[model samples]
Target: MDWTVKAGKLSPEKLRSLIFNRLHRRRSDILLRPGLGEDSAVIDFGDEVCVVSTDPITGASCRLGWLAVHVACNDVAANGAEPVGIQAALLLPEGVQDEFIGQLIDDMDAACAQLGIEILGGHTEVTTQVETPLVVITALGRAPRDRYVTSAGAQPGDIIYVTKGVGLEGTAVLASDHRETLLSLGVEEAVLQRAAGFFDRISVVPEALAAAEAGASAMHDITEGGFCGALWEVSAASGWGCEVMVEAVPVLPETKAICAALQLDPLALISSGSLLITAPPQVSIVEAVARVGAKAYPVGRVAAAAEPVLILPSGERRRLTMSVEDELWRFLAGK
Candidate 1:
C-alpha cells in the first residue's frame, strides 16, 4: 500500500511501528534511545548522562528565534537535566534582509543568555526553497545518572499534576502573529495584547527541576497537542492509564476567550509552557512547583485502565487517543 503523512506530529502508533522499532543502532552506552513519550535521548557517560533534544519553529511567525530555543530546551529540562547548550539551524528565504537575520540572532542569543545556555554552533543560509524563515534548535543538557527522569517512569499509583495554564504558546502566537485576523473576528485589542504576552511564559525549566527535586516519577512538557496530548503520552509511555478531571485543569481566561472566538478547543491547542508531572501519592509536587514561582494542581491519577480517559465536570468519561493534527495547525491553516 502507498502511504503518506500529514503536517504536525505523527500518531504514537505510527511512531512506534514505523520509526522507533526500525532503529538498528544499539549501544550499551545509549541509556535511552527513543520511545512513545520520551523526548530527549540519553547517552550514558559513566557518572552523568547527556540529554539531547531537537525542535523546530515552523508554526509561529512571531519570535521564531526565541521559540526555537525554549521549545527544544524544554525537552531536555523535562528529562530532569540542566539545559546547558544549544545549536541552531536557520533557513531564510531569498531576498531577506541582513538586518532581519541580525535581529533574529540577537533574539536567540538573548533567550539563551536568560537560561544560562551557550550557543554551541549551527548553520544558517538564505535559500529559495523556503517561503518563510524557519529556525530549528538542538538542545543539550546533563544530569547525574541517578537523577535523570523519563516519561516512562511513572507508576500506576502516582498522581498526575499540571503546571501553569494551558494553550500558552498557541494563544501567544495567534494573538501576535495573527493579530489583525483576531481583531477582525471581534476579539478585543486588550485581550489580544494580553494574550500576546504569553510568549514570556513559555519556559518550563524551573518547574521541571523543582518536580524532579521533589521526587517526580515522570515529566512531560505540554507542547504541540496541549495538556490532553501530554497526559496521553506519559500514560502510554508508562504502560498505564490516567483519569483526568476536566475541571481541575487550569485554563486561563484569555485562552478560553480567544479559543472561543476562533472556534477552537483550548485543550486541543498547542501549549508549550505547561508541564505534566507524575509523582508518588505522598509527594507534594504542587508545592514544589509553587516554590519556583509557578503553580501546579492535581488534575488526575494514574490507573490501570489501559487507556487514558478524561472525566468531565458533568461526570462524563471520554477516552483520549493521539491525533495526527493539533488544533493550532488547523487555526493556522485557516488563517
Candidate 2:
C-alpha cells in the first residue's frame, strides 16, 4: 500500500485504519487510550482517574505560550477534570532574542495563574531544525472515576449544545497574522482590533466544568476541524448520530466578515475555544453555560441514525464529514 503524508491531521478514515488499529499494548491501569474523540487519556489511580493531555502551539504565531497552556488545559477540562499543572516543552529558533523568550514565559505564567495551574518541569532548547518557535504543554488533571466524561457517552435524544461561538481562535489568529492584508482589503481598523481580541475567549474550561456539574453526557472541545468535524467525532465515538441545525449554530458578525474576506468557511475553520456538548433534552445546558458567563445554543440533537447530518433552515439536509485538511492551511497558503 502506498501512503501519503498530509499537512494537518490525518484523515479520520486513514487515522483509524493506519494508526488506531495498531494499539496492541494495553495496561490494566490505563482507563482510556487514544481514540478519535477522546481528548484526554485517563489513567486509573485507585481512588481517582488522572487525566492528561498534550498539545503543541503549531498554528498560531502569536501568543504561543498563552495558547499552549489553555489549549492543553481545555482538553483536560473537556474530560470534566480541572487542570492542576502543565509541563511545557519550549523549542526556540536559534536567532530568537532573550526578551522574546522571557515574554513567552511570562505569558504562559499569566495564563496558568488565571486557571490556577502550576508550571511543572519541562525541557527548553534552542534548535535550528525549525524556523519558528514551538511550545508544547502537557496538562495534568484528576477527577473521580465516575465523574470523568468521555466523548463516547452521548445518548440518543440528548440535546447538542455549543458554547461561545465557532471560529473564535481562528479569527484571532487570522486577525493577528493578516492585519495588513485585512487593512488593505478595506476592513476597518476597529474590526481588526476586535477580531484580534478574540484571544480572550479561547478557553472553554469554565463552561466545560459547568456543563459537567449540570449533568452533561459528553463534551468535546472544537479544534482543528471546527464544528462539523467535532460533531462527526462525538457521533463516531458514541456510536450514535446527530442532527446539527446549521442556522442555530451561532456565528459572530466579526467572524462572518473576516471569513468572507478571506474566502474561508467559518464552520470549517479551526476552532479551539468552543465546546460541543450533549445532555438530556430536559436539562438546561444553555443555562448552565450562561451561569458560567458564556453563551450557549442548542444547535441540534442526538439521533439513532448511523451518521451525522447537517440540517439547513430551508429544510435541506447534508451529511457532515471531516475535512481532510483544516481551512487554516488554505488561508495560509493563499497568504
Question: Which candidate gets the maximum TM-score versus the true structure?
Answer: 1
RMSD per model, one decimal: 1.3, 1.4
The list of candidate 1 runs beyond 4 A from truth reads: 1-4
lDDT of each: 0.89, 0.88
lDDT of 2: 0.88
> By how many angstroms RMSD does model 2 differ from the true structure?
1.4
Candidate 1 residue-wise lDDT, 121-183, digit = tens: 999988999999989899999998999999999898899888889899999999998888889
Cα-lDDT of candidate 1: 0.89
| C-alpha RMSD of candidate 1 | 1.3
Candidates in order, TM-scores: namely 0.97, 0.96
Stretches off by above 4 angstroms in model 2 are 1-3
